[model samples]
Every structure is written in C-alpha cells, then in structure tokens.
Target: MTTEPQRLQYLEAMGLTAWTARYRMPNARPTEACEWELPVPDDGARQAPGERLHALLDAPAEPSVPAPAAPAAEPRERPPAGERKARALLGGLVPEAASEEAAPGAAPEPARSVESDEPREALRFALQVACLDGRWLVVQPGQAAPSPLAQRLLANLLRAAGVTPEHPPAFEAFHWPQIEGLDVQAPLDEARQGLGAFLAGRARRGWAPERLLVFGDEATLARVLAIDDGRSTALDLPAWQGPALETLAGSAEAKRDLWPRLLDWRREWHGEAKGEAKGDA
Candidate 1:
C-alpha cells in the first residue's frame, strides 16, 4: 500500500538505512523483501515491501566537508607494529566489516562494504553532527562547515599545545607536525581518507560522527547523514579521542563535554543497534 514518495519520506525522516528485521510500517506484517536486496539509484523494480518504504528518502541531500589538508610532504611512515593487538577487537563494535553482501545474492562492490580494523570501542573522538545550507555539515576544518565555537576553541588550544589540526579529520590517518604526546595509530590526513571513503557510500552510510549534532532531533541528523546513501541512517565514531589538556586545540570544558557526549551517543546507540541486529539475526 506504500508508494515511492512515502518510502522515501520514511528514509528522509529516519535519515539512514533500515536493514533491521522489523517492517517500516511497524503495523505492516513482515514479508520476505527479496526485491529490496538490489542496489539503489536505477535498480527499478516493483520490489519488496521495504522498497516502497525505503525509497521515500532522497540521496546526495547533505554536504560533506572537505578533509584536512595533507602535510606539504608525506609524513615519514611510522613502522607498523610487528605485533599488534587482537584483530577482532573491533568486531564487538562494528561487528563485521561493511563489505559483507547486503543481500543474499548481491554483487560484491565497494558501496556494500563498511570496514573498521581498529578496536574502535576503546578510542575516543568528539562526534559533531550538524546540517546547514540544505546540505549536511561536516566538522572537517577547511572542508567542513566552520563552527565558530569549535574553531576558536580547538585552534587556540591546538596551536598553544603545539598540536596541528588535520583538515580532513581523524588522528590516525594524518601527521601532525606540531602536536606532541598523542599516540594515535594513524595521522589526521590518513584518518580523513578513510572517513572520506566512507562518505562516498551510496548515501550517508558512513562512520558514526563522534560529535553528532543537528538543529533538530536525532531524526534530523540521521536524514542528513544518509541523504546520499539509501542504506545509511545514522553515524557512529567508535574510536574518537582528544589531546591532553596542555596539548589540545579547544577549551578544556569543550573538549571534555563535547567528546564525552559523542561517546555517550555511541554507547547508547551501540546498545540499541546491537539489540536491533540481534533481532534481525
């Protein structure tokens, strides 16, 4: 009984993908949903019940910030630890790399895979999720929307602390010329590359923003993040951390308050998503 517009509305409303076991209508009875198992954008078919519900949302509706700039020259490659931690530590958080087939018989492609090798749960990052200009806003400085509050606090703190902020975002992927005493695995530039790749997903099927913020409710944030990818709804940054008080860019309060909230969001959603995934399983 649902139409494409209605389906898209749900997607827009939720701001992410829905692969859980429950039907979108909550009231609607469950069906096999074989048709929806196809890829998005031109995979036209009068498919499963979920399609009618999932299609209501739009794609490319949000704007992603540019990642942090790379250093003038590639940072000297640090030695990869010959002996690292357990590989599956991230398994408990992300569960599986997003690379698993979305549906039973779908083709293997980059869009269908979401990956995290690090043990994300133990890391810390301040997730800031925001939307503006009819497009979703990312916190990537230079590329991300400028937040006066964030920039002023982080920049001042970082410069004084000798910590250089990465433009693309993420500490693991890039190199910080000025920052000292941070032992994150990747540098800012490198981390941003991974985050950038995630956003390229069909929709907002990317990482959990450490600092998830929206003008409206959680639903608003979800919609903007997933606008480009039909399958993504919300974001989660399991591994986000900040510099020490003497070595950070933002105020001690902002860093403490903002980052913890981001982690709290993950903790809450992690519980919920785990439940949902289990239900689907």
Candidate 2:
C-alpha cells in the first residue's frame, strides 16, 4: 500500500498537481497539506519570459509608424483537396512538386485515404519457449521478469502438471525481425521459417520434445502452426493450444477452465493416467 507522501511524490513525478482541503474533516486524522515547492531564483538570476512580458506591459508604449498602402492583388482559385494535402505532406519544401499537375483545365486527382498512403507495418511476434519434461511450452511473451505473485502462480501451474525442481524448464526467447531496424518485406513467412529452423536445429541436437504446449489466441497460434513444411521436417510433436500466460495469471476462472484441457493433453501426449512426471532430455 502506498502512503500519502509517496502518492504525492508519484503525482509530482508525473507533473500532476495535488489539491488539499483547507479545513480538516471531522473524525479524520490531521494531515500535512500538499504544496508545490517552486524554486525561488536569486535577484541576480535572469528574468523569465513571463516576468519580462509583465515588465514590458507596465512600461510606456512607443508610437508606431504608418506604412504606405499597396494596390490590392487579384484573387486566385483554391487548389484541389489532394493538391492541398500533398503540399502539407511536403511542408512546401518542394514547391514545383506540389504544382506539377496544376495545369489549366486539368482534372483533379482522386483523394487517397491516409491509411492507404501509409505503408502497412510488418507482422511481429515474440514468444517465450520452454522445454520441460519432454514438452515444449510456447507462451506469449509477458513482462521481462514476472512479479513474485505471477511467479508463484506459474510455479503452482507447473507443480499441478507434475514438474519437479530436478527437471526445471529450459527457456528461450523467439522474436521476429531478430535484427532491430531490419526491414522485413514478408514478416509472416520469415517468422515461420525462423521458428521452423530453430525447432529443427533443436531436434537434430536430439532435444526433440514429444508434446508442444502453445499458449496464445487463435490468430497467434495459427502463425505457429503454419510452419509444418521443409523447415521443420524433423518435428512431429503433438500440440495443445490454450490461452496466453498473462491471461491465466490475471484470471482465476481462466485457470480453472484450463485444467480439463491440460489433463486431456497430458493423457494424450504423456500417456499419464494421473498428471505424472516424465523424464525430459
């Protein structure tokens, strides 16, 4: 639980101002008033723009000079909406580019939506892969490190699955666009290829798992499933897709709903009459 002073500090850090009641309420504990601690500058310090503006406003005003009037200019027609938008996009840096199609009697260009104009972002994915007791767990990446409470929940889940300390899960991270800032034309294909290669490499090293525990939504799980081709020819693991780890961590009802599915998978893959332990290589 956060104390009042700590809460005030947090608010100040976020650039928020806090207001306090002038009078104390009946049956309430007496509390110190929250106040802004604005720094006071020395007399020799430079004046702020506001102070200078106030000084200038208080000073005598100078007489302004009248300029000669010029002849009125002819009114021009407004350009089409597309041309106006193009000009705004270019910031008037290239004047000729904006007016290239401004020829007399030319048809207006069709308006394009901003969404259509912008390039679509590449599909990106991050997954937490863990190998435990002859099973591969591919979970949606959560916080870099889980909180103590979240860790406890994960431990409980593992224990329920008959995992032991002697067979701690081996973890790895998989991310698309592996090299930061690298432009990937087809991220979906690349991600599938990369993931497939990783799985195949692990299999060749004789670390193949019997079952795959996938934790993601349908859309996310689909991408992982689509890698069944040349790249992962060595793998033939049975899979069980379920809700993401973060979802299970936040919802007790979701955890309860997951047990039946987990038990079914354990029976099918591990052939465990009960959720019994299996030796993992």
Q: Top lDDT: which candidate number?
A: 2
Per-candidate clashes, comma-separated: 66, 0
lDDT, residue 247, candidate 2: 74
Taking all chains together, each candidate's TM-score versus the true structure is: 0.19, 0.43
**In candidate 1, what are the lDDT values of residues 1-281, reduced to their tens digit?**
44343343334333345455544675777667564355455666655545553443222235545558843453243222212212222233223423332576876755544434442221222333332221223333222334555546544543433333234232211111222333333333323332344344323533333332222123322323443322223343322233322233445564555553443333333444646544643
Q: What are the root-mean-square deviations of the candidates from the true structure over C-alphas?
A: 28.2, 17.9
Worst 10 residues of 1 by lDDT: 170-179
lDDT of 2 by residue, 1-281 (tens): 44454344334433356898689889999777998544557765467656765564455446455456855444253332454544543465333344554778888888877534332354566666666654544444542544456556666776676444346555566555444454444455545555665555555435556656565554553664543531222235566566666678888898989876654544444465542423331
Deviation in angstroms for 30 in model 2?
Answer: 87
The whole-model lDDT of each prediction reads 0.36, 0.54
Q: What would the TM-score be for candidate 2 when compared with the true structure?
A: 0.43
